[model samples]
Every structure is written in structure tokens, then in C-alpha cells.
Target: MKPIVTIAETTQPDGTVLALQEHDGRRFLLSDNVQIASPATKVSERELARIACAPFRPIRQPRIWVTGLALGELLEGLAESVPQKRATFYVAEPSDELADWHREFYPEGTFATDKRVFRVHGVDTGALNSLDSPLHGILLHADTAPLHPRGRGFFEDRRWLSVAYDTLQEGGLLAVASSRRVPKMDRNLENAGFEVAYHEIDAIPNARRPKTHHLWLARKGDYTSHAH
Candidate 1:
């Protein structure tokens, strides 16, 4: 068996170690010794993009916000799923080193040089409010979201979900995926004004035996105010 070799590494502001590594000619990323992304798991990322952009394909200038840049698979998935030339992708990644790793080690990666992608500071309310136009979709994955302080709140906090709701155009989608089911996720999204639809997809499409992943496609609905 081939051993995994570290190609490069960087320390985040919070002192966690992030590394780019390769094993048997395949590249992947690790955060604090835990694997976050690899070519082997790209099927789930592509599925995330496909489900998020499928409805908005007819819209010529759809704007999408993607949380995290791990190995650029989400952006690559978006490029393949959304063919509109005018579509834009806003990537929210708090770690400068992660972006740098993409550029330095994987220059050919889609998000590394894609003109349609604009890097944002984070996915907090302030960042969401700064957008000039409401987004058509927002793609999120539990393992790929930012690791900065308060970053995880975007997944569970009603207040933050409300901000996301307000940031989207009517009927826009917020697609979130996780390796395992999250209790009360549907209620949390509903509390934020989304019409939630749950789906289970093959994480590793087409294997002798397949494992399913949990995905929630929450679409924004009619105008309403909900207490946070």
C-alpha cells in the first residue's frame, strides 16, 4: 500500500493544522488530522451542486453562494452542473491558507482560477448582506463549512438561517448535506421561512454496496417574519 505524503501545510488562526496530502496519486485535504476532502468523496459534492442548481438552470444569471473551498470540488461541481455563462459563484472561506493551497498545489482546480468565483470573507450575516443581489442558491456541506468562530452556527441557528432566507431571491434554495441525519434540521429551516424537502442520495454512486447521505433542499417561501 502507498503511504500518504503531505504536500503542504498551513496553520489556521485558531492554531489548527491544515494539510494537503496525496496517496496513491490522489489528493485530499485534512484538518487537524481529520480527512475533510478527497477525490474519492467528490460524488457527494457533485450531487450537492446538481440538486442545488437543477431548478435554477433556466435562470440566465443565477447567483450562488458556496460555503468552504476545501478541495474546490463544490466549485467544480457547480461548473459542471450550471452551464449558464453568466452564473456567478460566491465562495465563503475564512482560511486564507486553504485558498492558497488550492492555488499553489492544485492550480488546475476549478475554483483556483475560475473567473466566475469570487472569494468572500465568511458566510455570516454581514457577508450575506453585502451582496449586491439576492442569491439563487446557497450550497452547504457539514464537513466543508468554515471553521472560524460562529461559523457552525449558520447550520443550526435560526437567526442565521433567517438571514440566509432574507438574502435569497424568492423561491431560491438553500441546499445542505450531511453524512448523517441531523435531528430537528427540518424544523430549524422551517422556522426560518423555508419550505423544506428532505432527500437521501447515494454518497458513492454505483458501488457494490452504497451508503446514503442526508440532504435538505430548503426553498424560500412567502414573506413572513419569525421571531429568532
Candidate 2:
């Protein structure tokens, strides 16, 4: 069997170690010896982005905000689905080191050099508040959201959800992906004045241990008539 080699590492403020490892040409990030990020889910993450942006296909220059830049899979997906030259993607990632790591190590994708992608080194609420115009979509993955740091997260906070709800255009969407279903999160989205829809996706279609991920699509307006 081949060995997993750690190509790079970063130490968190709380003394946790984050190591970037490669095994058989596949790269992954591990936090304190537990896998935190991997390209294994790239297909699912891309699909999540594609589904999230389905409502904006008819709109010109649709603006999207992504809560995190874990490996840039979501950004790649967005770039693929939204091909308009004027489209914009605002990526909010609190950790600067993560961005640096991607730049230094994972430089294969155009997401790193994509002119439409804007990097915001901060939290989701702050990034959303700083936007001059409302976004067409807000993308977030529950496990990779930048708001979590050993406590209650921005995704879980009602105030933040309200901000997200208000930051979006009338027919905009708030798409959230999670490894498991959390009923409270669904309720929270509904309580935040969004029309919520749930979807179950296969993260890995033919793997030995098939994994399912949940996606919640919340809309700000009565745009269900235009849903794709």
C-alpha cells in the first residue's frame, strides 16, 4: 500500500495542526489528524453550486457569494455554470493561510486566477454587509463555513441568517450543503423568511460506502415559477 505524505502544514491559533497530505496523487487537508477537506467531494460540491445557480441562468451578470473557499471546487462549479463574462463571485474566507495554501499548492485550476472571483478575507456577515448590490445567490457548506470556530456559527445564528436573507436580491437563493440532515437548520431557514426546499444527493455515487449529503435551497421571493 502507498503511504500518505503530508505536503504542507499549518497550525491553528487554538493549537490545532492542519496538515495538507497527498496519497496516490489525491490531496486532502487534515485538522488534528482528522480529514477536514478533500477533493473526493468535488463532484458533489460542484453539483451543489450548479443547483444553487439554476435560478440565475436567465439573469445577466448574476452575483454570487460563497461562504468558504475550501479547495475552490464550489468556485469552479460556479464559473462553469455561470459563463457570463460580467458575472461575479464573492468568496468569504476568514483564514488567510488557507488561501495562501491553495495558491502555493493547488494552482491547477483557473479559479485561482479567475478575474470574476473576489476574495474577502473575513466572515460571511461582514462580507455580505459590505456588498453594495444584493447577491443572486449565497453558497455555504455547513461543515466548511468560515463562521465556525469551536462555538455557535454564523450559519446557526438567526441574526446572520437574517443578514443573508436581506443581502440577497428578491429572487435570490441561499444554498446550504451538509453531510447530515439537521432539522433545526431547516426550521431556521424557514423562520428567516425563506421558502425552503430540501434535496438529497449522493456525494459518491459508486463508492464502497456510499455517502449522502443534504442540500437546502432557500429562496427570497416567489420565484418558484422560474426554478430550474
Candidate 3:
């Protein structure tokens, strides 16, 4: 196995250095206290497979928006599973170096090169405003506010939540995953006018071990809220 090499560094709130590492060929973000971010290789491809294949009833090819492009695994999985020729993907990320690293290190056939995929902005996700047109689906994989520090600012701001709500079309979906269980996540989605469903992805058979993740699928229209 090749030794891990440090690529770029960022500072955490506790005055700790967050290091981006490349081991063999895989990249990861680690801090002194914990692993900040990493590629989702541990989770079985089946879990992502289900998400990618989730039924979507779009009038035309749906316009999808994704925040936190990470290593592009989710994007790649989604592109492979969903074959809407008229689809468009809008991606947002905070780090330019991470984006460059993704383009350089990831495989050539990955989702980054897809013509429909667009790198829209390089800014903190908390500052993300409303989308110009309603989106068919919004995928958030970066961080969950109140559940994770990276997303704390977003959870604290109701305005941001409202922006997300307004960006989706009726019957649109907002799918998110968090490392830790967020009991209030469903309620928060309900408060934002979405019908929420929460499930543990790793609970399924043949799922990845030591890779606990919570999947929240929220819809914009008529369904009843599962939160209580």
C-alpha cells in the first residue's frame, strides 16, 4: 500500500488543521480529532444503487441540483442509474482545490465529465441562495446542520431552509444523508413544508459495516409528514 500524502490543509473551528490525504489513489479529509470527509467506498454500491434508481416522475428531463460534490461518487452513481437524456446537474462546492483534485485523480469515465453536469459555484453552502428555476431533485451530501459541525450555520438559519423549500418544484425531492442520526431532521423538514421519510441505509442486508448513515427523503408536495 502506498503511504498517504497530504495534499491541502484547512483550519477547523477548534484551531486544528484539517488535512486532505491521498492514499494509494484515494483521497480523504482528516482532522486531528476525527475523519472530516472521505470517499463513500465502504457503503455497498447497492445502497447508492437504490437512491439512483428511485422513481422520478418528471414532466421533462429533470433538473437536479447537488451540493458538496465530494469525490464525485454520488454524482457518478446517479448519472449511471438515471438515464434521462434531458437531465441537467448543477453542483456546488466550497473548495477549488478539492474540485481540481476531483478532476485530476478520479477515473476518466466518472460523472465529472458528463455534459449535463455543471460546476455552478465555489462558495460556502450556507450562503447558497435560491435556485433560478424549480429543481426536480436536490441532493445534499456535504453536511447536515445541527447534526454536523460543517453544517451548523445552515441549521441555525431558518431563512436558508426556506430558500431550499422555495427552490424545489411541487412533488420535487430533497435527499440528504448524515453520518450521525439526527432525530430532529425529520421535524425540520416538516417545518420547511416537506413530507419527510427517514431510514438507515446501512441496516439493509449486505450493507457496509462501520458505515452508518441516515437517509432523509423529503418531498415538496401533498404527502403527510412522517415526523411527529
Candidate 4:
């Protein structure tokens, strides 16, 4: 059974009057001062799944890196999209509580017990520099600020793009979802030596009304442009 949730107006430490919500007895972090009663129907997981699996459709199977394993919803979607027996999956989460919650409440046939999957390094996504693996795809769902920022210099750091570039193999794809539209995100990926593509995806149901997300797909080395 789904848990009951409550919404309240609150202020952040930065003095932003954002809407706060609690779901399944846990508080969720959201942007745009918006709130919802249940997390079971949020845009986050849909955004993650679209960004993670949309690029490599023709490939027989692809190895994927899923950063920010919040609630394991993204991982579960990814497992369903890709052939579990043929694909390799890695999920990185920074919070133990989130991982534990996923293990307890999520569906029974989710990505939890898959042998081809590996869960590791519950640290910040920024520390992904140490990750050594040949990846066909990388999905960044932790924070969009590294791609688009309301604050200066928050997304301009080159190391994040560099790490993303270094992690992908030639013809590999990297997709990130931004809360707001960011033209600079395209330029940043290009500056990092990737041919970038951009798309806008519909937000999940019942969380925020008429909200859409910006998705950026950048490819390392050479690839045909699909997003003109």
C-alpha cells in the first residue's frame, strides 16, 4: 500500500520559500517551490529512466552507470528497459537511508537481486573521478545545478563535464536532466569535447502541473546528430 503524505510551505536556509512535502513518512527534496502529497508519482524517476535508457536503443545490450540512486526507482526502471540478463548495471547512491528504504518498500521483482548489477561507493556523484569502468551510457540524475544553475559558477565547473567525457567510450552517450532550460549546458558539453544533443521531456504526473524537463544527451568521439 502507498503511504500517505503531507505538504506544507516552508523556507530553505537560502531563504527560498519552497513547498515541502513528506511521502511514505519521508521528506523529499524538490525545486520551484512546489510540493506534492506522494512521491510514488513524481517526475524524478521518469526523468531518470528517460535519460538513462533513451539513447542506446539499437545496441544489443549496453552497460550503464546510474548516478544518484534515490529510492532506487530509476534503477528499477533501467532494469526493466534493458535486458537484465545481457546488460551490466551500476548504481551509486550517497544516502544509506534511501538505499535501505528501497530495499524495504519497492516492488518485489525490481533490480535489487540481479546478479549482473553492482552497487558501490555510496558517495557524492562529484567524486565519480575514481570510477574505472568502460561505460556505454552514463545517467546523471543527482542534481541539475551542475548543468544549469540559478547561482553563478555552480554549473560552470569543467571537471564535472571532463569526468563525464572520460567515463564514456567512443560513441557512448551521457544524458542529464535539468530542472530549467539551460543553453549553456549544450556549450559546456561541446567544450568538454562532446557532440551534444538536447530534448525536452514531459514531467511525471501529479507532482507539478504543466512542468517539463530539459534533457541533454552528449556523445563522446563521433556520432551522427539526432537532435537538430
Candidate 5:
């Protein structure tokens, strides 16, 4: 068998190491020692996207933003859930090389190909601003949970959460996935003015795994003071 090859590597400002590795024909994007994305996590990860995209099904040509491009499983799942030719997904991936690795290893394009996504390269997804049309849904399933060395505080930072809230259309959805439950993040989400629902998922459903996952699905209320 071939060794797991490191396709690209970069050190974050905080001295965190980000590497894209390939093993057994599968690519793994790692934030230090933690597993960010890989084939092993695909099923459960897709399940996360599935749960997030379900409520927004009635929206026509719903626009969605996915913060990370670690693996395209989330996008794949979003594709399955929305299944609309006109649905547009804006994928904000901070690392261009990592995105390249994804294209090289998993094939370029988002959600099965290039049909579903408008890939945003080299942008800090955390600082994303509102769009011309508010997003119908936003899925944040990046490398690590908030406060982790590699998380970049996607959920922990109130600024980011605020931006996420304002970036969404009324009644839009925001879903966050993490390896474990975060009480603080839950509170932060609430403070950011979302009516949140939390769900726990097996990392690999129907298959035993020591790791569990937490998917927080929050909806932006159409009215009644949840606005930022």
C-alpha cells in the first residue's frame, strides 16, 4: 500500500499546522492532530447537512453558504436535501492550496461537480458579510470546534455569529457541527439571537465509534425581536 502523502501544508499564525493528506485513496484534511474531514466521517457529516437543509426545502432557489471545503460531503448532502438545479451554494474556503487538494483528490467543483456551488477561495469565512440576497441557510462544519486551536472561533466569536445572523434571510437556518457538545457555544448562539435546537449524532451511525457529534440547528425567526 502507498504511504499517506501530504499534498499541502501550512502553519497558521497561532502556530497551528494544517495539512492535507491522502491515504488509501482517501484525503484527510487535518487541523493539527484532529481529523477535520475524511471518508470515514462522510456518512455522518452528510447526515448533519441533511438535517440542516430539510426545513429550508420549501424556499425556492435558496442560497446557502458553507464555511469550509474540507471534504465535499456536506455539499453532497446539501445537494441531496435541496435537489434543486437553481440552488446556489457559496463555499468559503480559506486555504487555496487545500481547496486545490480537494479538487485534485476529490475532483474539482462543489456538490458532485461545479453545478451547485460558487466557490469562494482564500476568504476568511468567519468575516463573511451579508450578500445582496440574504442566504436561506448557512452550514458551518469547518475543521474544529470553537476555542480549539484551529477553529478560528467560528461559533465562539460573537462577531462571526452576529454576521451569520444578519447574513441570513428571515426564517433562514444556521447549522453548526462539532465533535462534541459545547455549552458555551450554545449560549453564545442564543445570545446571538437564534432559537436553537441541538441534536447528537453518532460519528458513524449504526456503526459503533467512540466519537460522538453535536449538530446545532438554529433558525432565524421571521419576526419578534430576534434580529441583530
Candidate 6:
């Protein structure tokens, strides 16, 4: 086995050291304290994203907010899963190193050549605050679980959840893919006023292990925010 190579490192304001590691054709981005945000070998994470975006009934030219564009698996899944041909993806990824890896590794694939993806780089949920219009769906696959610190207090702060709640068009969907299921995560989404559903998938595709991957689906509301 080849040793893990550190590609890029970022220091959080809290003095946390986050490093991106490459090994066996996969990239792992995480803080020194926890392991999360790996798109290369985290096949289960991709599965989680796919599961989160279920029963898709997107309106015309539906706009999707993808908080994490890890290797563009979710984007690929979304672009393939949705019936609509016209769609736009707002990709919020704070790591420049990761984006570079995406480009170098998958130039003509999911992230690079996809005409629909728009990348946003920020330390936190900077992209979520500014909304030109109500969105049809929002998919979050940040460094870790929703309660993790990678989002710059996105899940830690209730106001951010409210922003998500308000930004969605009625019947819109919000999905999150996480390595582990945090305590009270479902309750927190409920507090944010979303009808949430939970799913557990394999941590790695075709690998034998307990179902550890977590996927949460939250619908905005029953009626369309726009005219029916």
C-alpha cells in the first residue's frame, strides 16, 4: 500500500489542521481530528447522495444547490436521475485543492465538462445565503455530518437551516450524505420544518460491512412555492 500523500492543507480559524490526502487514486479531505470528505474511494457516500435524491419530480429547469461537490458523484447522479434535461447545479466547495483534483482527475467527466455545474469556493456556507430565487432541491455533502464543523457552523446554527427552509420552492427537496448519523440530526431537521426520511447504505460498494453511511431526505413542503 502506498503511503498517503498530503496535497493541500488549510488551517481553520479554530486552529484545526485540515489536510487533503491522496492514496490509491482517492482523495481524503479532513481535519486532523476526524475523517470525512472523501470522494474518491467513498463509494458509499456517492450511494448516499443517490439515495438522498429519490423520487425526483423536478419542475422546469430545476435549480439544485449542491453544498459539496466531492468528485461530482452527486452531480452525476442528479444530472442522470432527474427527468428534466435542463438543470443547473450550484456547487459549493470550499477547497481549491479538491476542485483542482476534480479537474485533473475527471476533466471530461462529472465536474469539469458538465455545463450545469457552477462551483462556489468559501470557508463556510457562503453560497447558501444569497438566493436569486427559490430552488427546487438542495443537496449537502460537506466534510462530515450536518452537525460537523466543516460547514462553518451551518448545522450548528439554526438560522442557516431556516435559510435553507425559506430558500426552497414548495415541494423542493433537501438531502445530506454523511459518514455517520449524528444524534438528534433528524430532530434538528424536523425543527427546521422539513419532513425528513433516513436511509442507511453501505460504507463501500460491494464491500462487506455494516450499513454505516447515512442519507437524509427532507422535503420543503406539500404545495409548490410558485403557482400550481
Give each model's whole-structure lDDT. 0.83, 0.81, 0.60, 0.59, 0.72, 0.67
In angstroms, how far off is 9's CA in candidate 4? Answer: 19
TM-score of every prediction relative to native: 0.92, 0.91, 0.75, 0.68, 0.82, 0.78
Model 6 global lDDT (CA atoms, 0 to 1): 0.67
Flag regions of model 3 displaced more than 4 Å.
7-19, 31-34, 39-49, 57-59, 107-111, 122-130, 142-156, 203-211, 222-228
* Candidate 3 lDDT, 116-151, residue by residue in tens: 887765323343453566776777653411123443
* Colliding pairs, model 5: none
Cα deviation of 217, candidate 2, in Å:
0.1
Arrange candidates by lDDT, descending.
1, 2, 5, 6, 3, 4
Question: Evaluated with lDDT, which candidate comes out highest?
Answer: 1
Model 4 lowest lDDT segment of ten: 144-153
Instruction: Mark the regions of model 2 whose C-alpha exceeds 4 Å error after superposition.
Output: 224-228
RMSD of each: 3.7, 2.4, 5.1, 6.5, 3.8, 3.5
Candidate 1 is scored at a TM of 0.92
lDDT of 1 by residue, 1-228 (tens): 889899999888888889999999998888889888876557778889998888877778889999888888888999888888888999998888888878888788777777888999777888889899888889988766765365453779777788899998887889998877888999999888899999987987677888888889998863233111
For candidate 1, give the lDDT of residue 8.
92
Which portions of model 1 miss their true places by more than 4 Å?
A: 148-153, 222-228
lDDT of 5 by residue, 92-211 (tens): 766666666667766744543667687765334343663576888888763432232344556777777888888888877789887656668778889999988888877765665456
> For this target, which candidate reaches the highest TM-score against the unseen true structure?
1
Candidate 4: where is the Cα deviation over 4 Å? 1-44, 58-61, 107-111, 122-129, 142-156, 204-209, 223-228
Clashing pairs in 2: none
Better of 4 and 5 by lDDT: 5
Q: How well is each residue in 1-228 modelled by candidate 6, as lDDT tens digits?
A: 798887767775656676767888776767664666665325654564456545455455777777666556666777666546676777777766667877876787768887877886642434576667777777776444323364453654677777888888888777866665667778888999999988776665565665466777888777444512
lDDT of 6 at 207: 51
- Residue 184 lDDT in candidate 6: 77
The local lDDT score (0 to 100) that residue 88 gets in candidate 2 is 88
TM-score of candidate 4 on Cα atoms, chains taken together: 0.68
